[model samples]
Target: MGSTSARTETCKSTSEREIAALFDRWNQSLQTGDPRKVVANYADRSVLLPTVSNTPRLDAAQKLDYFQHFLENKPFGRIDSRTIEIGCTSAVDAGLYTFTFARTGAVVKARYTYTYKWDGSQWLITSHHSSAMPEK
Candidate 1:
């Protein structure tokens, strides 16, 4: 591979690594009930297609609005895993996650996938899809 291509691969891998870290960070932020911190890793135009809720937003502010609502219930979670697959400037991550609410003490375990794109310099999340596991 050319040096540029190699760099792109490195970038893609780095993004996948960061996605795992971001999940933990985001979950911690959610535990804290702070929307801004929770949404920090997402791109300005990111969309969260959660299998948990009905609210959908087009921008950060709108997304945060959804987070704010979620925070009202003191929602929190932990990401247990993350795996990445990259192609060109696109990357996809699939993993298992768990959530705990301070108020409800409910443990929400689920599977999640995040899609990101390299916007030339930085890796930004373009889409986030999450689905909850059936209660056992």
Candidate 2:
């Protein structure tokens, strides 16, 4: 008989419905019109490639900078198409979305992809990439 040491690892799994719910929560956060609240959805080590901004936000301050101006438009986003992929402790939601800006009464269609990670307690956005539609 051989003696062996046993180790245990904790794994987290998320469902398709749950991933959609996470996007819902993120959309709801944007409705708050508070940049801080919007930033809360992201992890400290997160990246945001915003729709309107040319800068790639790599830190909280940069993300806050983008959201500060973005929230001013009072943008409300709705998913037009969604494809969700779930993995162990991570997920990606990629699709098209439309944003209606109340301040300017402008409707912008965009492509978006959000990657999230389960950080022990809750899901946080790890990477967000969004771009406006190029077609006229």
* TM-score for each of the candidates: 0.72, 0.92
Alpha carbon lDDT of residue 97, candidate 1?
82
Q: What's the lDDT of the predicted structure labeled candidate 2? A: 0.93
Q: lDDT of each model, Cα atoms only?
A: 0.73, 0.93
lDDT of 1 by residue, 19-131 (tens): 46555666667776688887776888788977568766668887787788778768766668778787777778788888777777877898888877777776667888888
Per-candidate count of clashing residue pairs (backbone under 3 Å): 1, 0
Task: Count residue pairs with overlapping backbones in model 2.
Answer: 0
